[model samples]
Target: MKIYSYPSHVKQDIKEFIEKRLDSGTFGLLVQGDEDTIEDVKDLMFDQDDVTGNGSGSYTFNTLKAEECLVGNWDLLREAKEELQPNVDLIEKGPEFCDVMIRCYLLDWCFNKALAEIVNNTETVQKGDN
Candidate 1:
């Protein structure tokens, strides 16, 4: 299958923020919304490992952000910026990615994407209501 590679325009800090989270081991970005009846709280936990499992009734990009789900973690967004100070990790590797100032804006999008398709065929999903 095709993997989701970072767009060439993606800034280095954003890449590092996402990649750092990827390296942080198994984590799921719990996305919640109102669908079906809009009264029921629909919850779908997108595992970093499960993003690769875009098959069947399991998690797909369509389901991740679909259902008009307004999902995002304010703390993660803040931490992403604070946790990794001064983008040194990427610089040490070499000339890191350079581009526009879209990093902060796309941090939430990185949860399911960017981290998707990196792993092979994984087909399990965790969905619930809360």
Candidate 2:
């Protein structure tokens, strides 16, 4: 999916898709970025600890943080993809850091899908309040 720096009408499609799943009128989106990027994001939030909040705000933050982190290390993903080609399909789907960074990031996406659903549920709940 393409990342955006600003919230434009372009996101209307995803917003609508998310709206369809809002149970309580709230929608949430979860995205994964590189560990270094996540670390930087986590660092930026050093004092912000509340996980329960607006989905729109959180999604924007995640996308931005991931974009920064991924861009900073795009080469690592490419290298790993090249090096692991011999036996990539054999690796167990777990937290095992490999030569490539994006592999874990990609795996993080698999795990984050569930989180996105929960966030979507939250988003739906929030929408009902609007």
Candidate 3:
């Protein structure tokens, strides 16, 4: 999947724009970056105190401060594909809607990757069974 990082200052605006699209029935997913990037994003989205260590090596966002706005991470997306069977599509609304289009492309890329893995595994199993 193509990774695109928006400017830190624009994250809130981006989230708001994404929210509107989501509200209008547009399906898009926002995958978080690495641990450091996650911390940076949390700083962009919430106050300092709202982000805390989860006792594990990683951190957790306090729900009391802000609602979860971003989509699931890569692992979560893969799990969702396996368990939830999400129907994904590449949406192209043209240049005027470039932002959402990019998101759609990313989601499409990720979904296709997962689908290919599933198909390959199925074929491997079938060959073993033969």
> CA lDDT of each candidate?
0.29, 0.36, 0.32
Number of the top lDDT candidate: 2
| TM-score, per-candidate, Cα-based | 0.22, 0.22, 0.24
Greater lDDT among 1 and 2 belongs to 2
Question: Which of the two, 2 or 3, has more lDDT?
Answer: 2
What ranges in model 1 sit over 4 Å off? 1-6, 9-101, 121-130
CA lDDT for candidate 3: 0.32
Candidate 1: residue 24 lDDT (0-100): 32
lDDT per residue for candidate 1 within 1-130, as digits (tens), equals 2322323223233334344643332223212221331111111212222321112222223533322221233333344335444453433322111101113234335533433432221222322221
In the range 1-130, model 3's lDDT, one tens digit per residue, is 3232322213333344334433322221123213454334334333221121212212223332111212223343344344433454313222212222222323333333433444466578879999
Ranking by TM-score: 3, 2, 1
